[model samples]
Target chain A: LAKTTQPISMDSYEGQEVNITCSHNNIATNDYITWYQQFPSQGPRFIIQGYKTKVTNEVASLFIPADRKSSTLSLPRVSLSDTAVYYCLVVTNNQGGKLIFGQGTELSVKP
Target chain B: DTAVSQTPKYLVTQMGNDKSIKCEQNLGHDTMYWYKQDSKKFLKIMFSYNNKELIINETVPNRFSPKSPDKAHLNLHINSLELGDSAVYFCASSQGTVVTTIYFGEGSWLTVV
Candidate 1:
């Protein structure tokens, strides 16, 4: 599994765009980038995933550059409810492979 | 409907006691997993089962035993629990053993005193 690095924390105001970047320099070709959001005292929720280019969903958007070594999770018009810890994971189509989570970026959305 | 659910949302027990946490997924997924989140907020996989077969067993303590009676149910039983065992345990399931996104439950908080 490829190790990932991301910011420890970020601060954003409501109605602002928040971008969290993750670096996976050793990302393999078959690896897919996935982002998950975790609130305090709750399970982590899948936000968006992408192999390459940009993938957008109702909740968030994931941008993967050509090299695939890094990706960015974009949350549009953040709210206080969006304050949570975001994790970036690199995985493949393998069974039983662990989802190695790094110290996720804590985004605090202020009102 | 609850896709994944766990019983005993909060468990408070004395040290050296045995306890069990039950989990069931209504998503009809073939793979179920148990994860432990420590005080530092680090999430680690403890066990994974596919179709009632043990697939991934991390380097967890032998006291932690996971049993899956069927594809939709996975239960975790801890023997001789210690204070360090206090943490949030999450149950998750995926469509298959492959790299599909796993859906998680609300998690069970275990407090060993």
Candidate 2:
């Protein structure tokens, strides 16, 4: 079975901060929580990845609590173009790090 | 300036046909992968190769074969295709044997009618 779970969909308006959470109860020690955004007719694009605490890149922020059971992807002041399917995956470090993808959360950014 | 690229962006073929999708990465990554996204929007890993050697093989059918000629390329060849084989095929690459935030190509849409 796949190792991650996320909401099916979310709605956000322009200029609003959007946060999508994913649960991975059995995440391994070497596993990294990574998020990817995919637009129609395109492949998944890497957004943000984190191992612990909080990691922020220019595009998004990743927050992982102490338990490592869940993580949240935060998009600041989202726009309509930010609307896309966001996938949460757990990537292990051993044996070339297997990445298992789940049914991503469809984020709808309203005007 | 594309990092990863795949050929035959779209393909339409009848069942039992043999087709192939070629992928190349210029990012000098040592690991590459093939991922399939079905109509239901479920994305799954099909195969993984490191330095032109097969490493990870999912439970995909034998008809779906992956060929990595070198560190820079991994090609997918499907034999005896079925209607269930239609989906978006994505080629991805990473820098090392341990998976990092990999890079993906635009994807090749293969339709088996």
Instruction: Write model 1 residue lDDT over A62-107, tens digit each, in one string.
Output: 9999999899999999999999999999988784646877889999
Give the fraction of reference interface contacts each candidate recovers: 0.56, 0.64
lDDT per residue for candidate 2 within A35-109, as digits (tens), equals 999998889999988999999999999999999999999999999999899999988766574567789999999
Residue ranges of candidate 2 with Cα displaced over 4 Å:
none
Predicted candidate 2 versus true structure: per-residue lDDT over B1-113, tens digit per residue: 89999999999999999999999999999999999999888988899999999988989899989998889999999999999999999999998876658898999999989
List the global CA lDDT of all models.
0.92, 0.91
Assess candidate 1 and give its lDDT: 0.92
**Residue A10 displacement (Å), model 2:** 0.7
In candidate 2 chain B, what residue range of length 10 has the lowest lDDT sum? B95-104
lDDT of 2 at B99: 67
Least accurate 10 contiguous residues by lDDT in model 2 chain A: A92-101
DockQ of each: 0.68, 0.70
Work out the TM-score per prediction.
0.98, 0.96
Which candidate has the top score in lDDT?
Answer: 1
